[model samples]
Target: MSAAETAAETAAETATRRTPGLVPVGETLRSAERGPRQPAADPGTPPARMPWSFWRLLGSELGLTFRRPRNLLMLAALGVVPIVIGVALRVVAAEDGMGGIIEDVAGNSLMLTFVSFSFLVLLFMPVVVSVVAGDSIAGEAGAGTLRYLLAAPSGRTRLLAVKYVNAVVFAYAVTAAVALPALATGLVLFPAGDVTLLSGTTISMGDGLLRIVIAVGYVGAGMAALAAVALAMSTFTEVSIGAIAATIVLIIVCQVLRAIPELGSITPYLLPTRFTNFDAVLRSPIDTAAMGEGLLAFGAYILLFGSIAWARFSGKDITS
Candidate 1:
């Protein structure tokens, strides 16, 4: 073979080796004609989060909250407690000569509501609200669903807002649970009439019913306060029980402290400690001025705690 042919073969081999995984120059040029593919996006920007879509989010929470045994137990207790109280009042009044069966029957509506809700606000309502609200986020996290929720198309802010609303709504629902049945039973057992006011005035049955409904509204406000506190504590705990326990303990302690008599003037400011006084509703005229103040204070506490909880929830890792 001639030196010229040999040199030409060597050059060809070198050129091929230099272009690893190379196609023909013509093919390479043709491929380059197609522009870069969408810049090979990095894991996508992650579509904006839309956490709260009202009915949608509430439906999700309702399904989960009802699954809770604690909530079921609360419902049972809500029913049972009032009936027991009614029977007790029936017996006690008989012995004390407060009234006969007819009078008792007439008074049952307002009386039973007063008794049942008093029991709830003093303990059961707070516990129920805390358990449900507190567990909302933290429980989801514990169950390993928090991360999935965070990653969902819903925005984090909206998501947390929905959760917060769910907590408040659940609080109202659970709190009202005892009220409805108790009132119904009382009305069946006792005769109802215009509420007797503190000032020796009487409100017709219609007016009394309206006042009672108004009281329910105020109590709902109280429940919202409890829900806010529970939701805040919930952010601190992965176990819903932890949030529940903390709220219960705090409430009990505050209540005990407020009952000290000497704490009288300032006690009502303790938010959940001295708020609901049923007398305000049954009296001659609605006298909610005091409770209104307490409600304002409770509102402040709820807002403060709720803000912190939301901020924390927004920043949490949400691994689960």
Candidate 2:
């Protein structure tokens, strides 16, 4: 090569040298200059995020949900559980007569509350809520579908909201499943008319129904809090099983505490035990102080865990 040509070539080579941690722009330009022009990002394309629509996200989630066996099993349980339990109790208790059941409920809010906490709000419903919430976002990340969802126009906040709603809805459904059967059976078999309450009172069916609704509502709130806890755990784990298992362990630990003698005293101080007492509504005069305390404790749990989970989720490099 001629000296003049060599000097020019050396200058071009020096211009194309790469800088650390950055693309070699000059070299890239040289190569691309000989190639076809690239197309710009399409404006028509949806935003590379979860579409903020509530039901829209739910649609995507439902599709993802139906494809999985775990969610389906949970749904099935939500539907059939109440019917079965109600039927069985109806049959067995029929031999003894509804009179005894009504007597038990009449003037006995503590029994009702104990039954409520023991069965629905305390553990079972919380587990279901946590499973759905914990699995909603984390399961996607675990299964490598989170990127696709995040790209679908839904933002992290919207995604979390949808999951929370789904968890609440499902939790309500599950509680009704467990409760309605018992309630309906109790109503049909036992005379659910004006009944005496623990507080030396009598209330008509309407009043009792109102109390039931309120108690169920608290159950829903407790479930929501537990769901938040599970979701927090989920952010830390890709494996849905780990999230669900962790939630179950948290519940089991509470139940074990409730069973121990002196520890059982402290157990009532625990939110789980507090959540278990729905029968308090049936008492002549409902004692809601403990229930109130439980709800507040659960609320605190929801705020703390939910904030952490949201921070982690929103701050994470979600492309993976």
Candidate 3:
């Protein structure tokens, strides 16, 4: 073969050798234009889902609620009140020699706990619970963080659920803040022994503590119901204070109505009226029927208010 022909043949051979590994310029341009290739999904595989961690969101919410200075201060005030009540009773008993219900409470630590609950649950507990629940959504909205929260993977319904659950948990915590301190203060200040029920029957100290536990649980349920009302109010406004004030006003109005003889028929349905049903636990046999009625009322309030809150919040325009 000629030299030129041999050179041409060698070049051809080299080009042929490289062709398998080399992409055509047109194919390269097209591939570049097409961008990255995604792997084909298998028919059996589930579709990709947004990562939503409900528990984590709840935990974070609880942490924020508990850590707030205002909330902590309120809890401190609740814890302190029981101590003040026990001390005041002890002082009164020492000076004036007490009478009637005061005499009973002065002589017994268990009775003192019940008395403290009686005084606090009427106003203090509902106030604190109202503040927390009323602030849940409205506070977020007022601060402009609510829209950002909604922007995340957390759905509105899930967010609302978390807010309500957090409020309920805080309600229980508020109840404990009262009961535990009252019990501790009572044990420190008064005599601990058998407890005399309102029915004139006596129970062991252990049984008395159990009764106190039941009372605390019942009171906590009542507070949770109140929280639901406050949460519903929260959904209607961006101002947290407005919601809080509205709930407190509603509570006061209900209490005023309950005091009127003319409203006797409606008193049975009032939420504040149910707050005192923990007294049923003071009876020897334990007034389960009355307590059951109170619990049913609480459940009804929770359901009604919860639905209202959900309805309002789901459609609320988050401009903040």
Measured by TM-score, how close is model 1 to the native structure? 0.77
Model 3 global lDDT (CA atoms, 0 to 1): 0.88
In model 1, which runs have C-alpha deviations exceeding 4 angstroms? 1-54, 67-69, 99-108, 262-266
Instruction: Quote each prediction's TM-score.
Output: 0.77, 0.71, 0.84
lDDT by residue (1-320, candidate 3, tens digit) is 99999999999988777543333434333443443466998999996443346788999999999999999999999999989988888888886756877788876799877888889998989999999999999999888887667755567777899999999999999999999999999899889999888898888999999999999899999999999999999999999999999999999999999889998999999999999999998897999999999999999999999999998777665667
On residues 1-320, what C-alpha lDDT tens digit does candidate 1 reach at each position? 99999999999988767443323423333333432345554676773233335568768777777777877787677777878777677666565446543343445466577667766787877777777777877887788776566544455566667788887777667757777777777886666775555466777878767766877777878878878888888888778788888988988988888879987887856766644754577665556776667678778988898898877765554444
Error of 2 at 100 (Å): 7.6
How many pairs of residues in model 3 come into backbone collision? Answer: 0
Error of 2 at 212 (Å): 1.0
Q: If both were scored by TM-score, which would come out higher, candidate 2 or candidate 3?
A: 3
Local error of candidate 2 at residue 69 (angstroms): 6.1
Question: Considering lDDT, where higher is better, how would the candidates rank from best to worst?
Answer: 3, 1, 2
| lDDT for 227 (candidate 1) | 80
Local distance difference test, each candidate? 0.70, 0.65, 0.88
